[model samples]
Target: MQSFFKTNWIHSLWLILLFAGSLVGETVTPKDRLIVETLIRLNRFDVSGNEKWKGAVQRYARSQRGEEGYFELVEQFSVEAELPELLRLVEEDPTSALSAKSVQLIFRLGEQKKLSRLLSGSPKKKANAIITLIGFVKTPEAQKLLDEHKALSAPATSVAKGAPALISTADDIKALAARTGNVKQGKVVFQKFCFACHKAGDLGLDFGPGLSEIGSKLPKSELLLAIVKPNAGISFDYEGWTVETKQGSFLAGIVSESDEELTVRMVGGVSQKVKKADIAKRTKMKASLMPEGLHLAMSEMELVDLVEFLSSLRTR
Candidate 1:
C-alpha cells in the first residue's frame, strides 16, 4: 500500500542515510520508520542471523535512547547484526537493564569467544548479565565463566516464550538480489517447508501447480513472488472457491461445479462433494489456494536457497 517501488530499495536507503548524518530529524515523520525498516529490510535479525547492521543501529541508538520513537526502532532489527552493540552493553555497563538482553543476544549468536572475553574482564553491573548469559549459554566454558563469578551473581533464571519471526516479501526480494543459494541446502529447505503442497519431480503432492519444471516455465523473480506472495497473482485453475453448505460447513479450495453437485478440491488432493441444493453460498476467493505469508516460516538465507533449488528444476 505504501510507495515502496524503486530501482533499488537499499540504495534508496543510502540516499536518505547520507542526508540524515546532518539531517537526522525527530521520529515525527514517516522517514524515521522508513530508515529503520530499510536498514533491516534485507535480513530479519534473529539470534541465528543478521550482520553489522546491528552495530550501526545500536551505536546510533545510544545517543537517542530518550528520543520519541526509539523503542519502535529497537523492535525492528534482529540477527548476527547484534553481537557488538549488545556484547558491548554487556561488557561495559553490565548493570544496565539493557545488559540482560545484550547478554541474551550475545549468547544466541554463540559468540562464545567474545562472551568468554567479556567474562574474563569484570564489570560492576554484571550480576544480571551473568545470570542471563548462564541461563542461555550452557557450554562448559560458559559454566566456568559463571563459576569464576558465582558468588557475585544470583541463580540463573529461565523463561520460554515463542515469538513469531518477522520477514516481508519485499525484504526477501532485496536480500536475495545480493545473495546466492546452495542448491543442496535449498532442497533440504524445500522438503522442510514446501514439499507437502507443491509437486516437483516425482516428489510431493499435486494439490497445487506441479513445479517439476517450473524453472523452465517461470523466471527467478516470478518464482520468488509465487512463494512469498501467492495471492499477488492467482494462476488459472488455481483460484480458490469457498462453498458454504446448508449444514453450516465452509469448504475452500479449487471447485468443479455441475448442474446438481459441487466438487471442492483442497490441499493434499482431498476433495469434497456437495449437492448443489445443500449449498447455502458459493463465492470465489480473492487469493490463491497457495497460502500467503509462507515466507514468515523461513529465514531469508533459506529462502534464497529455496529459490535456487526451484530454479534448478528445469527441462533437460
Candidate 2:
C-alpha cells in the first residue's frame, strides 16, 4: 500500500473530483469551502462556457500561491489570459504526458521559434528540448533545432535502434528476458546507470522515483518494458521543465515557480533559482528525465542482471 502511494500520488492529484452540489445549507471549513466553491465554479465553466469564469479561475489560482498544473484548466477552457499558463505547465511538469501534449500543441499553434527561445535558456532546458524534439517526431523544424544542439544530444528513445535495450518488439523483449541474470552483477549495473536518477536502499539519488518497492508492484516483464521504453510508462513525479531568461540563459529540472521566481531542483540534489521578471519565457519537453540507452553504456547481459537486481527489491 505504501509503495503504491509513492508511485500513484500524481494520479490522485490529476483526478480532481467535483462536488457538484449546492453549499448553501451545508457546513464546511474555510479551506474546504473555498475548494468546494472553486470546484463548483469549474463545473459551471465546463457547461456554460462562461468567459468571465476563465478570468476568475486564473485569479483564484494566483491567489493560491501559483498553483501547479493549472495549464490543464487553461487549455480546457481556452482561457486567453492563461495562454502563458501552457509554458508554466511545461516548466512545472515537463516530463508529464500533459506537458508533452502541450509541446505538440505549441507546434500546431505555429510557435516554432519558442523552442529556440527555450534552447537558449539553460543547460538542462536545451538537453530536455533536444530530447523532446527527438521524442516528438512530427514537430516542424525539429531536425533543424536538433542539429544546433547536436553537442548535447541524449539517446533518441523514439527512433534510434542503435542500443540493444532500446526495444519495442516482442522478440526483443523475449530475447532480453531469457538471459540468465546474476544478482551481484545486476547490483553493479544498477549503481552505474540507474543510481543517478533513482535510489534503491540508499544507493542513488532520488531525482527520479524510488524503486525500492517496484518489484512488489510490477513483474520482471514489466520492469524490462520500463527500461527499454521508459517514456512509455513514465511517472508524473519526474516531470521536467526549462526556464529561459532575457539574458539568454536558462535552467532545467524539477521546478517550483511562484509569482516572483522559479526554483529548479536538478539531479544530484542540485537546485537553482531565477526571477520571473528576468525570465523571457519557459519551455517544456515530452521526454523522460532518465535518458534512453543506459543499456548502451553496458553489455546486454548487464541489462539482464540490472533487471534481476531491480526484481529482487520487494517491499521490505
Tens-place lDDT per residue, model 2, 201-314, is 867656678898887988777888888777776687567776667976445567777988887665543344677888897777577666665565467777788888888889
TM-score of 2: 0.48
List model 1 lDDT by residue over 226-255, tens digit each.
887787788887787878889776666688
What stretches of model 1 exceed 4 Å from their correct place?
1-178
- Candidate 2 residue spans exceeding 4 A from truth: 1-166, 178-180
RMSD of 2: 16.3
On TM-score, the candidate that comes out on top is 2
